[model samples]
Target: MRRREFLKGCASLSACSLLFPSFVFAYSGQPLKRYKRAHLVWEDGRPVKAKEIKPEEEYLFFYPFRATPCLLVNTQQKLKGAKLRLEDGKEYIWKGGIGPGRSIVAFVAICTHQLSYPTRERTLISYHPPGKKSSLLERDRVIQCCAHMSAFDPAKGGKVIEGPAKDPLPAVILSEENGKIYAEAVLGRDLFEEFFDVYRRELRKEYGSSKKAKEEVNRCVTTPLRKYTKEVIRC
Candidate 1:
């Protein structure tokens, strides 16, 4: 190619890079965009206590079980991990332990695979020691999704064991308070909540339809991706 042509192309690419550096790296080695997370307060108008959470306790009002800020009171002692969601829209790498006589070790509740929300509704298989089989029983550790069979050690910063997931779940900063477990700085709680509300309504409307419930559901699912592009890309 001519030198003039090459110079012009370089100039054009440089300008474009300056404009959307985040998108450029999104495909290669640039890290995923990390946003600031605000602290999550409990329904009682107090900061989340970081003490051992009991089983059957609700952390986030939306989901139940050991997912995201949900309480899991166990009777074992050792380092453990679980999938948890912070109030923020981002996931975390949570790890902790249940003192031998202690009650439980809790963390965020998000699947390591594409951030799919895993629940106690099903069993999730995970790899704890980086490449070992770790069955995520609803009653034991975090409910790892069996979709791709990803394992995570809650005590070890929710590390991925054997699966396609590359990054560990984000960890919510935690602290103990007055004998209660308090979670701190959930990545994307409020935004997800808001988005979830609108998304839920649309899904309900679509599902409530009898003739094309499946079609409606598919549309409802993809609708957010469209909306997200509109808001982020300003299209």
Candidate 2:
């Protein structure tokens, strides 16, 4: 099936968590994107307290406009010694959520493989560490999607530990202000087709059962090619 059709079917089946990462930019040596977002409050109308997040368990949350699902896992210890490789051959240490013993890190919850969403529903596969007969060590403390068996390390800037995804899960940078954690920026590509696909769905609603109408609705942004490779990936 065509890629678009496959994605549509996945959406219908709620199989949005298959890790089909098409963020494939020839990143042999290049720079990824940098970003900062406005104040994003919790959908539940309360600050996520550090005390509530148990060790090695995940806390799921949504963002502005409910555009995407973000996965937060607290390791009870600060995430340390993880490598963050930028597209531009730069590397850095990411202590996601400050220091050890209160380390809570968030990642783009959409599976990079197919831009699929992982859930606690039937798709839920309990976390299994390495050395298990069927374990995929890409490491522990991960956000896993059973759909395509894609896994990502939430503590390590969403790096693909093991899966078909070529790129890391786009890091949703978080910051603490006035004693509350807020997503400050996205330090990589946009969630696959988030707004663009929304427009496509809206167009379908506007022009039901009309192929010509669907064809007539032009997309504002096609998948764009990078203009410059030397741009800096902000931390």
Candidate 3:
């Protein structure tokens, strides 16, 4: 089936549909968290200007919580608004990208399949820009998790297009002002609890404690994924 048709069919299926068993179901309601507004800044603390972001580059930043990472991208093309559906069949409209050219977007970096995320040592998941070959059969731009081969369409609110992941990556809603971008909130099912549970030992070793790891942030530094991690393991 064509990609568009497959996505449409997936979206229209009921919770009781055959595809339900394959979905990694999360809590029912769409959870929305309005975090303390955090400015996306550089290491020197200068605000990250939206217009200066290079197209198709993957930037990483931590927000809402100190331990949780998010991916920022500029696809360089105006994106269509996408209707995103959660595993339990809940739906919400992602209002396309923000900033100049309406091409900038961001999402929580943790994979819904198993919560695998980018770490300082290595990243199991990362953005594969258009024309970039990935282990996944699809060659289009996607946020891919090599751990399980789940691929998410960055242009479509991080919708899962392949592999086992069922929920769209939770979006980090952004707002731009005075040419700078800020993360305002996260919209989608709550996955932080599960992520924390699975990574508690690592989080404690890096953050001192799980509580500290979850602390709200007022400033976030944006760095290129290469600068953010020591290695990128592409499958």
Candidate 4:
């Protein structure tokens, strides 16, 4: 009876280990600092008069309409809004919020899973591969990547929930000057590129050499061996 009980306990533990393998190598979430807006177009490819926008209205920019960059002014008092883009020489529609009063939220238009751009369909876009759903609605509440069905909370700065996404979508910053709102920056900080450098050092201390032990041995032995052979031939 004692042996049977021990075997059952081991089986249960093994099952639990297989069920939660994700916890073994979870990704960390660290906050990046917010940055000011830069590189925005207003009228005729000119800098936006940021302070000119009013609280109750949302300004829109349409790219490549005729002469490349066109400004579409919509002062709708509702929360829903639309903007068109031609970034990377491709056409994409961005659907999000006009907010209650001068509030703005922005997210990357690409699907995090496969980079398939989702088109707006009454605030929701559905994916075909495995059939998933995501959306952007009313004041940047959430930007959903439909390919993997990952929902990101923009107010919380693009944190991910549900689906297969392990990283948040890159965020765009906004600023106002002369009552007009303009995009400031993407992901707030340029330091995001250095994330891997910080993580690799931490991993080395905790998990040992990320480089193979065999590779390190091969490098050290080959260099000394070649030098010793040269010395012997000279003698």
Candidate 5:
């Protein structure tokens, strides 16, 4: 079956309740959050122009919170909007990619499975463009986590196409004005509280305090995934 059809079937299946018991009937009702608009800037603090972003390249930035990382991508295709279902059973429409060709998209980098994220030292989760081989059999464009081999399809609202991730990656809602991109909000269930609890010491070391780490970001520096993380572990 085609990928789109498969996703549609997934959306309609009652069996999903069994496959994802943690998400079944656990409707929190709240599925989205409007964050302070954050400009995507370069390391020098200059706004990142949408046109300059290379196709299939992955960029990393912080959004909504200082400690939370997001992945930006230019998929080089006009993507289709998707219906994203949250753990709480709430659903929302992801209006698809933005910018020229409707190719630009972004998603929270923390893995939905275990919250593995990109860091200055290493990244267990990273994007693999088409034709690039990873530990997984999938060679298509995917954001994969080596920690547990969870793979999300960036072109499909970060849908989990493989492995243990039961929920979709939270998408970063993006807008463009005068060729520059801005992150306006996040859509889907966020694991911020669990993330904080699990990584408290690391957060404190990086941002001085958990409170500081959770501070809303106004402007975020966008860097290539390679430059942002010293090591990229693909599995």
Candidate 6:
């Protein structure tokens, strides 16, 4: 009787649709088109004139549209943002779209899990992959989303240190002139909206028409690799 009951329970479990992996997302191979240099604007659309944040702190701003939120942070070293093949036989830190130097950094705040954005406070705890020892090459800090517990290393070009998330959060390339910072363009795939690519195609033709401007916008990037196991790349 117990064996028969166990077989019936197994059949019931097989009929369940709810599961951990609702779906898996892959990289879109299209050339990045969104994000052109523009005046820094506040959430209310007023032009910003000066610095509003201090070191190790972040200030949130919205531009291009309300649905997109960007983050500007002050980090110690901008060296680990993204590893890019900028020169002969060597990869350089691509600013991951943010400007060079450790003074300030900017990136889109959209989380990779379900495309939900994490809060501004430094609330995520540090993490290490199972059975793997920590190293200096790994990121020192991680920004976590409580929704799914995925963590992104802000210093390492917003790479996903822990997951269900398979991609890094897209970056908002920034430029600083005199004493003010501006949102230039976005890097990487959109986390939540599938229609963003369509919108970028039209926006690109309008803003990034010039070849020189297009090249300038294209150089900085972070390439996230696909790994089905825990031995994932850190930078």
Candidate 5 at residue 111, lDDT? 94
- 1-235 in candidate 6: lDDT tens per residue? 3434544665454343221111100112222334445566544444444345444334555543443445665554545446433112333233543344543556666665565542223322222322333353343444555456667666776666677776766666565567556665555554424424434553355456333223332122211111111232232
Candidate 2, 30: how far from true, in Å? 10
lDDT of 3 by residue, 1-235 (tens): 5434654768566733444222112212335567888999988889999877877578999988999999998877778768888999889777666876567999999999999999999999998866676765647567889898988887888888886999989888787878878887787767988999999999999999999999999999999998989999886
- The reply for model 2, stretches above 4 Å from the true place, is 1-44, 86-95, 99-102, 119-139, 194-235
| Each prediction's whole-model lDDT (CA) | 0.36, 0.48, 0.82, 0.33, 0.82, 0.46
- Could you tell me the lDDT of residue 105 within candidate 3? 90
Any runs in candidate 1 off by more than 4 Å, and if so which? 1-75, 80-104, 118-142, 186-235
Judged by whole-model lDDT over C-alpha atoms, candidate 5 comes out at 0.82
Model 4: per-residue Cα lDDT over 37-99, one tens digit each:
233443354454434333333222211111011111212234332322222332222233233
Model 3 accuracy (lDDT, Cα): 0.82
Model 4 regions lying over 4 Å from their true place:
1-102, 119-140, 188-235
TM of each candidate vs. truth: 0.39, 0.56, 0.84, 0.34, 0.84, 0.51
User: Of the candidates shown, which would achieve the greatest TM-score relative to the real structure?
Assistant: 3
Let me know the TM-score candidate 2 reaches against the reference structure: 0.56
lDDT for position 21 in model 2:
25
Better of 1 and 4 by lDDT: 1
Question: Which residue pairs collide in model 5, if any?
Answer: 27-88
Q: What is candidate 5's lDDT per residue for 115-215, written digit by digit as tens? A: 99998999999988756766565475788998988988888898888879888999888878777788877878778888889999999999999999999
Predicted candidate 2 versus true structure: per-residue lDDT over 1-235, tens digit per residue: 6556766777543354333322211121223332333343334445555555555344455442233455556655556536666444466444456324437666666666666553322233323323222344444566666666766666667766676765567665555556656564455445545533644554355446334222311111111011111221111
- How would you order the candidates by TM-score, starting with the best? 3, 5, 2, 6, 1, 4
Candidate 3 segments exceeding 4 Å error: 1-31
Lowest lDDT block of 10, candidate 6:
19-28
**What's model 1's overall lDDT?**
0.36
lDDT of 6 at 185: 52
